[model samples]
Target chain A: MNLRIKLIPYERLKREDAKKLVKDLKEGTIILVDAKLDPKEEADLIEETMKVVSTKFSGIELSSMELSELKETTNFERFKNMVIERIMGKKRGLTIIGPAKIIRKIEKNPEELLLYM
Target chain B: MVVKHFRRLKNRLASAIRKVFKKKKEIKIGLYGPVNSGKTTLANRICVDWLGEELGKVTSIPHETREIQMKEKVTIKDNGRSLTFNLVDTPGIATKIDFEDFLKFGMKRKEAKERAKEATRGVIESIKWLDKMDMVLVVLDSTRSPINQVNITILGNLDARNIPLLIVSNKVDLKSSSTSRVRTAFPGYDVIGISAKTGAMVNELYKMVLKKI
Candidate 1:
């Protein structure tokens, strides 16, 4: 089986719609985004994924980790990190999206993400 | 000072108007969670407590409540205060559904495939029904880690829609159950640990629900 993994910057993912991402997933390509998608984006992606679910394309296995959520931070540091995230317009972390048929699960820990294929 | 006072008055008026309008509409409290997270069990507990019956079937299998099952006019009373709403028991949300998983439960191949198809549709229907809920109870298995994409998505969507939510850390009767873990996972949210099967801490849940809605 030919497997393709695509690394996409958060900016490009934000610019494009989720339908385009689902299309790539349908073609058996795994997606890796540089930044953790915010809740709304994650919800939107799930909605898009559900719309395309079929016998062949069951759905996606998605997991993300935000850098701010990784370690314990003081109020001041957390405020600073929040400011930085707002300035960057994205959370500092990583997101993995894979086709459910190929990827069994994406187990998430507070510090890291483990993908099982 | 004059502008601030005027703004305060306007805000008060808007809030009053909202309450008045809210009273005229039927409130819907939805059960939303991951597959096999004991949402239906909790639903049954809530229904049996107030309505004298169960809302849906509970099973070890995922997606047993594939359709949206609702119990209307479920009113819970606490300290002379009663809150009435339609309790919506939705299909558990899932990102993936594989028929092979069901085959392990000793189901026929055709039955498993059919269940898989219905489960996918159930997921879609659950997502579609999100907008209709006024409040939501997000049920999570206390034995499992709560920092997953599904939980995050469900919480995020509810937050985005400005819906009031309470996180339920279910299955606390199990030895591995840890409500503190669920609390620590989502620090800012309200998390209640309960055993729906044993009716443990369920009254507290009802009180919390009354307060939340």
Candidate 2:
């Protein structure tokens, strides 16, 4: 319910920073990131997060689909699962790119997001 | 001629059978949460899963739930009660967007601040109905870092009224989900994690509520 969603840049994060992020996040925090603003750094972030969070995370590709279409992919479904689990007070985590392009793509393909949150 | 008569007789019998069990008990269930926390999505999921009809709109933009939405006569059999649970979904509660943030994006400072003030007032108006509900389901988005003030305010007010609450961790199906922390943040309340989209833990949620209401 905290109106202020904490924005964290994946670029500024260290490999061992999960503990802190986890602490702030478990407290019901929202993070805002700009993935498309810096593709290289975002890619590095996704890569580094996977390394840290392990295989429980999956790779997702949106291509040119709108936001709606993006949600339908198996990967989006997985992300929604992670989000839902977190909300339930479960501790599983996932790594996702906060790309406006990706957001646009999913928006274009809203159907894909239909099955997931 | 004989076929017509038989069809008419069948239709009459069906109506008679339905009438015998027409009476239903209605229970009102309310879904409330902060902005962007998926209140409508949860409501849409319930409509799809239980009512077989999606009654509300879903949007990613915060404050999309600007008004109170109610879907009446939702029938659910719980414990020994034959109940009709009306699902009421409310808008997000956020202190309006700071005018300075918009001004920083290139708007006039005074104009931006005024707009921000108006937005803050809108948020208050949207959440004022918390006092009139039978139950409150606080929806929290799990992907973000947990913040204390807004939810604490919501929970504190609800607790003051002694309203039975069910904290729903929505979007739980997303990757990087940390629900345990969500549980810890809210010390004394019934919490449940669910994929509102996949309908994962909803049935279990029903079981929990069945005991309470």
Candidate 3:
């Protein structure tokens, strides 16, 4: 019953950012990441995060979404332009990371993604 | 690499081990887990499959099974061989059994208290009967977190006694279910997810059971 979520713009993700993420994950926080923020470096950061928490139980589930789909729902997110710019900038979806000990499972639905946001 | 090598060695030696346990015509397979995790449901599935009868009643209420239930001489048909077993369905184990918890479900306080005491005794008996188990199925709800201490303690005790075991992650029929989480939690153990109520992936479980023992 412990449902937790966090939204992070992966485009701005840094090595230090990854370190903090490792800490939050240990606390059982499910982090949602956007790859557009730092497209070139998110994967490496995730890899780094994996290595940091590798000895512990963990998992990741990713789901993709179109920026247009998100925009249609909220009538225009104040951050829609940023998301669109980022999607155009090559960020395509959301990546969820959490302690597998708690996160357990995930279901993908882009439309429902806003609720978590 | 070490785990891989150990598994290879274990597989190489499984037949020899099987020969020893196989001599006892009725291998005792214990069904154990926390309350409402579906141990009885799986037990019923196995019993019905081999004996044409359900093992016991299954309900949504916790600790409904306050005593050990048994079904004997269930012969399982594997690849080309038949294996018989005495399926032992035990009461759920809990660190704390509070009558108040049962009272929340609308049971009278007096009955709830009595049930709690019986459940606590059942837990003790289940632990004592561990020695009777030739092998055990640690059934768990796949939709829930696998970090509970009850199962961990049971697993540790089983490890100490060198009892062979397989984790049955039940209720994979739920949308929120994920065997992968159980897999990650017990990286070294074989964990299988199945919906015992619907009999999904049960054949896979049967094959794994044959391989495990």
Candidate 4:
């Protein structure tokens, strides 16, 4: 099986609906988002994934890591990052979404994410 | 700005009035978390502590509790202060439920498929029931990393809905369990470490629950 990984900007992701993401996932393509999705967006994605679960398409394995959450920073730096995230409408990080059938699990650590197939 | 302030005040006043007149019997405290996070164990502990019975069956398999189970009129007394409310044990939430995963646990192929299908529906029902909870206990396995999408999403949805919540870092009896890790993952929430299986520090959890409600 040919493995396909699609890199999607967070802006484009926000512009497009989660259905599009789920569609890519259904086709067995791994998706990499430029920014970590907020909790609501993640929840929305899970809901969308659940709607499309079938025998072939089980669901999605999603994991995200925020840059700000990785390292300890001063209060000022934290505030600055927050301001930037608010202005940009997404956190500075990386998110990986893949079909659960393909990727068995996404092990997450404080600093990194490991995808196991 | 004045209108905004007035609206805030009005909302506060209305909320206060509602709290004053609200019936205690209607209060629903929900147990929510990812799959295999020991939510059922916690529920059973709470039930046996207050109601002299267990709420549901617990197992090593994921998605064991595929439906919402509720026990009413559970009253907990702490320091001479008693509180009573309905306890709701919800099915564990997961982003995926592949039938093949269950086959590894010695389940038959047909039974695995059925369990997977029911598990998917259970996830949907759990999410749908979130809005009905007066308060939620987000149970997390302390032995596992707490930064997963399910944990983040659960915490986020609760925050979005303005629902009061407490993070229950369960399985403290395990050597790998670390409540500090859970705290580090989620810094601003109320976190309590407990061993639901062993009934360790559960009284502290009860006190925290009473304080939250």
Scored by TM-score, the top model is 1
Q: Candidate 3's residue-wise lDDT over B1-213, tens digit each? A: 344356545644653675676685558889988788999999989888888999899888898998999988888887796667889999986544556678788999788877766776677667778877878899999998885445655665665456778899999999999999988766667789999999999888888888767
TM-score of 4: 0.87
**Candidate 2 has what TM-score?**
0.51
lDDT tens digits, residue span B68-111, model 4: 99999889999988878889999888898789899999999999
| Residue lDDT tens for model 1, B143-162 | 99898888999987877676
Cα error of candidate 1 at position B180, Å: 1.6
Residue A5 CA error for candidate 3 (Å)? 34
Q: Which digits, one per residue and each the tens of the lDDT, describe model 1 over residues A16-76?
A: 9999999999889999999989887887787788777766888899998887775775667
Query: A-chain TM-score per prediction?
Result: 0.93, 0.30, 0.49, 0.93
lDDT of each: 0.86, 0.54, 0.69, 0.87
Candidate 2 chain A worst ten-residue window by lDDT: A54-63
TM-score of each: 0.89, 0.51, 0.62, 0.87
lDDT (C-alpha) at residue A99 in model 4: 94
DockQ of each: 0.58, 0.02, 0.02, 0.56
Judge candidate 3 at residue B15 and give its lDDT: 39
Ranking by TM-score: 1, 4, 3, 2
User: Of 3 and 4, which scores higher on lDDT?
Assistant: 4
Give per-residue CA lDDT, model 2, range B21-139, as digits (tens).
Answer: 53343445778777788888888877876789997778554455656788987776656755557888876765224344555556686765554554444454445666556666888
What root-mean-square deviation over C-alphas does model 4 reach?
Answer: 4.7
Q: Give stretches of model 1 more than 4 Å off.
A: A72-74, B1-21
